[model samples]
Target: MALFIFRSIPMNTYELDCPAVPFETVGKTVAQVVSRIEQRLRKAELEPEWVVAANWIDDANDSLHGLKADALWPVVVEGESRLCLSVAIGRSEGWLVQIDHVRLHKAGDGGHWSSVALLRIKTLTRTHAWAVAAAMSRLLEID
Candidate 1:
C-alpha cells in the first residue's frame, strides 16, 4: 500500500493605495502606468483583462503632457462570485505598484460587468516587480 500526504496553503493576496508606500505615480498618467504594467504582465505571462496605453503622450518626457496619471490592471482569479485582483499601476520615475481586490459581477441577467466592491490597497515597488509579476502569473495559470 502507498501512503499519500495532503497539504493546504493560503492563497496569496496583494493590494495598493495613494500616498503609495513602496512607490508612487507622482508624474505618471493612468495610460502610462497601465502600459508599463501591461508590458511586465505580458512578459511574465500574467496578462490582465485589458491594458490602455497613453495616446496623447507616450513618454513621460514632459510631466505636464500626460493625462489621467493613474490606472489599474484587472486580473482574474479562479473562483466563483466574480472576485478579481486589481493592481494600481502608477507612472513615475520608478513604477508605482499597488495590489487589491475587486468584485466584478453582472448588474442583472444581461447587464454588463461592473466592479462592486474593493479592499484596502497594499503598495509595492519596482524592485519587487518581477517577483510579484511571476507570482501573479502563477496564480493565474490555468490547470
Candidate 2:
C-alpha cells in the first residue's frame, strides 16, 4: 500500500497514485477541448501562464495543417494511442522541473471538453513539477 510505486504496464505504464474526477466528455473539436481546459484551469484558480500551451496537429491527413499552441496542446488519439505532454514548472530553487509523458485521452463522446487520459509522469520528481502536475490535473481532470 505504498504510494509512489512505479509500475510498467501497457495502458498506463506511468500512472500515478492520485485522485481524479469521473470521466466526462464535453467537446467535438480540439478547439473546444482547449477552451474547456482553459476554463477549467481558470476556475481552479490557476494562472494563465501556468497553463503553458495547447494545440492540435492533424495526423490523419499526413500534413502539418492546423495547429494551436497556447495553454492546451492537441494530439490525435486513436483508440489506445495516448498523447503525451511535457510541462516545465519554475521552482524556488532557480531551476525548472520537467514533467514528461503526461498522457491525454479522447472521451468516446465529444461535446464540449474532449475526454483525455491521464498518465503519471515518472520523470517528474521535483516539488515544483509535482505541484504543477497536481494543480494541472485538478484543472484538467486527466485522472
Which number leads on lDDT? 1
Q: Distance (Å) between predicted and true CA of 86, model 1?
A: 5.3
State which candidate has the highest TM-score. 2
lDDT of 1 by residue, 81-114 (tens): 3334444445433333233333345456544433
Worst 10-residue lDDT window for candidate 2 reads: 93-102
State candidate 2's TM-score: 0.36
- lDDT tens digits, residue span 1-143, model 2: 77797787543212243336622433334444444555654554432443321223333321222233322333435454334344453343222322222233445664232333222222223544455455545434443
Worst 10 residues of 1 by lDDT: 15-24
RMSD of 2: 12.4
Listed in order, each prediction's TM-score against the native is: 0.27, 0.36
Off by over 4 Å in 1: 2-24, 52-143
Q: What's the CA error at residue 72 for candidate 1, in Å? A: 12
